[model samples]
Target chain A: MPHDHHDHDHPAHSPPQPDDKVHSYYQILGVALKELLIEKGIVTADEVRSAIEKRDQITPAHGAAVVARAWSDAGFRTRLLTDANAAVAELGYPMTTTRLVAVENTADVHNVVVCTLCSCYPRELLGLPPAWYKSRAYRARIVHEPRAVLAEFGTQLLEETEVRVHDSTADMRFLVVPRRPAGTESLDEAALAELVSRDSMIGVAVVRQP
Target chain B: MRGPHDVGGLDDGPIDPAPHELGFWEKQIDGLRGVIGAKVIVTTHENRRYVESLGDDAYETLTYYERWTAALSRQMVDKGLLTQAEIDARVRVVRERLAASGELAPGAEDVKP
Candidate 1:
């Protein structure tokens, strides 16, 4: 008699085991120091470690630089529009390993990003993705129906604002460079960077004048 | 050759008695090939019956698999084994197959390769 015994035998191959390591919530960002330690003897380990350290040190400064450039230089903004990665690199904050796509939120189009898979993020450029960003609720809901998800995050866009939801699949990731808010025209670049929370980059929160 | 139960701690984290976590029996069934593939399909299905059978937790887990499959499909497309159109077609086909089989529940459709 022909039976599905081959299928039956499959599950019997291995038994369930318990996961003892309670992963640190922060480790999900892949910025944890231990990853560097594990790669100590490897060729690129030193560079990776240095890159992570540099990323942590310069995230705020990078934000400031972008804001400053936008405020002062029209050409820089155009360059940012054309190739954000290169523009950021020219400013001395090159994204490491992670490919970055800067989604520009304008009067017509609003952009939101989510890593529906294992969190592929632009840690070098945007720092860590917030805890909510990595949550199962956000991961499952965002890509399917983004407007509803953004509403949950307290960002309500006008009907005229086209919502572009960019799904961060495997290799590439994204960050939202929101349009400069109206009231913030008076504030300097440093002040503007302070208002740019990680959530703003993820497109959950808009940068507001402080 | 890897059993679904074996993957528990490796990927699923610590076990709990809650119905949300896959139990021993559930893991056994999930280790079967058809169940994994069908669960992947159920996530993409819009049909109410297929959606309801997946339950909330299973649907969430399946989302991870869907991402995995999407990445794999993209890679396959890039490598020329399939095209983007073909991958989209496969996703539609898989969804239809799962919906018709009435095995949208976790581990309900375990088939041998």
Candidate 2:
């Protein structure tokens, strides 16, 4: 589950809300391009509408389910680590654009993903990436100092624990399967999935049972 | 030796980590990119290349989707999918309608067509 997640309860931060009253050059351009394309019969209006609807349906929960399954089943975890794309597809969450690489977080090593060039993300399973993921500070500094970035997210790792950062590219994406919290072995898959957050899947925050 | 977009390992400022709800236009632009990619009108790589080529100025000034909108406009022209004149004309029409309905931003008209 590298791409989209449908759940809207983002972990943290409050971004400025878009003002519908103001329309800009690019906004008008976006509208015009879609209209012109539809006017020319290149694509139907219905098609574009449907595409928007479909995008809205995907969210981080999709990735959480995948992580939960991997936590509960060792065989599935093996398959997920071996062939993440096919493993997710078997769960009915197929990769639409890029190849998915599920990186597991062990007690000795923690993994995180970022796109240094641009906002390359697993949009299918993780839904849209958070604005912070696209910010210059996070992009530039994460690779340089992941522990600091992780600390900002309130994730503190032991000194001996290794931090591995994966830079997502145009053709490939990364999803982090966080180590399940202790004392959660009695929980079912559904309950386990509830504990996985978007930030955890992005490797910014670790999964913690409440 | 780094491109404007190659910001990894730079001593940039602290991350805000704020998550804002996307605007309608932002989401629309994203959907347009998705649909256009599905149609094979433009490859995702091409879009990334175009956005990366937007230089330091645009990368600094525009928001995420604004960069995509601007780059997509350039790609459409370069690919001959649409003419600049046609885009401008449609924009003018839409702008006029919005203006008439008093929906334009307070000083959005200050920007050139």
Clashes of each: 0, 19
Over the stretch A101-170, how does candidate 1's per-residue lDDT look in tens digits?
7777888888888765435567656654444555455656666566767777678888778887787744
What is the C-alpha lDDT profile of model 2 across B1-113, one tens digit per residue?
Answer: 88878999999778987677888887888888888899999988899899889877667756788789889989989988899999999989988878788877666654542
Maximum-lDDT candidate: 2
lDDT of 1 by residue, B1-113 (tens): 53221111122221121212322222222222122233333222222224233333333333322223323333334446445564444434443454476423333233211
Residue-level error in angstroms, candidate 2, position A15: 6.2
Candidate 1 regions exceeding 4 Å error are: A1-52, A58-61, B1-113
Predicted candidate 2 versus true structure: per-residue lDDT over A38-79, tens digit per residue: 888877878878888998999999999999999999999999
Error of 1 at B19 (Å): 27
Query: Model 1: clashing residue pairs?
Result: none
How many Å off is the CA of A142 in candidate 2? 0.4
Evaluate model 1 with DockQ and give the value.
0.03
A40, model 1: CA deviation in Å? Answer: 9.7
List the candidates' TM-scores in order.
0.51, 0.93
